[model samples]
Target: MMGFAVLLHVMAVVIWVGGMFFAYVVLRPVAAGQLEPPARLTLWAGVFGRFFPWVWACVGVVLATGLWMIFAVFGGMGGVGLYVHAMFGLGLLMMLIFFHVFFAPYGRLKRAVAAQDWQAGGKALAQIRMLVGINTLIGLLTIAVGAAGRYLVP
Candidate 1:
């Protein structure tokens, strides 16, 4: 059970963080360089349309597995170490950010694309990009905390 939990945890992180990396580093630059504003924005909208569902899944898995590990294995929230608490806090924050990005800017981007309003789509895409960059940084930090937290735990 512990091993399964660990696998789920790692896979969740990988999917979430890896998706962010692909969006920010690879897709962003490639779309910017290769496509016109309309095409680029439309492509981004399509990309997020596909990717956000996976992020939602990953978020659910991460939260479920993390809470299960804390409650079932650690005996409850009070039993969790400070580092685990920190990781959970930041991870929850990340999830909230993702929720905002998905429901707000991402939705706007999709609408703009559907309407063929390239400028509005670009603006919405920018909003999503900024939020995603912030979330990516937080996700990376959470991974660091997870890896090193045990040593720092009291």
Candidate 2:
């Protein structure tokens, strides 16, 4: 049903985007201030290890629900509004960025933490911080677009 699909899609987006916001804004600052390299790095590595799985699952659910809504409820991509198209594009972009983060910097972060290589871990964390910050901003923008775009379009 449209209602169910919309609910799932929104919930998935909330989990992914809200998690990023919390990590980038709240956790990162407190962790950096309170913890030194080894502890900070360990915390992030552990945090990410736990969080990434949920994020990946959220990604799958969001994509599935979104497509279901578009094709089944809204009568395909052609029938959807520009807002839907924008949201779809932004969601795909976020997913691609997440894949890069998971494979590249996140991989290095895990390896560095395992090896107790603080320097490498720091570098990887910095990269992740930057990327996540960017993603968070973009996620917020996407939400705004999705929420308000219908009214704005005409």
Candidate 2 lDDT over 65-147, as tens digits, reads: 98988888888989989998999999899999999999999999999999999999999999999999999998999999888
- Model 1, residue 97: distance off in Å is 0.4
lDDT for each candidate structure: 0.91, 0.93
**Model 2, backbone clash pairs (residues 3+ apart or across chains), number:** 0
Cα lDDT of candidate 2 equals 0.93
TM-score, candidate 2, is 0.97
lDDT of 1: 0.91
- Model 2 poorest ten-residue lDDT run: 1-10
- The digit string of per-residue lDDT tens for model 1 on 12-80 reads 899999999889988888888999988888788878878888999999999999999998999998998
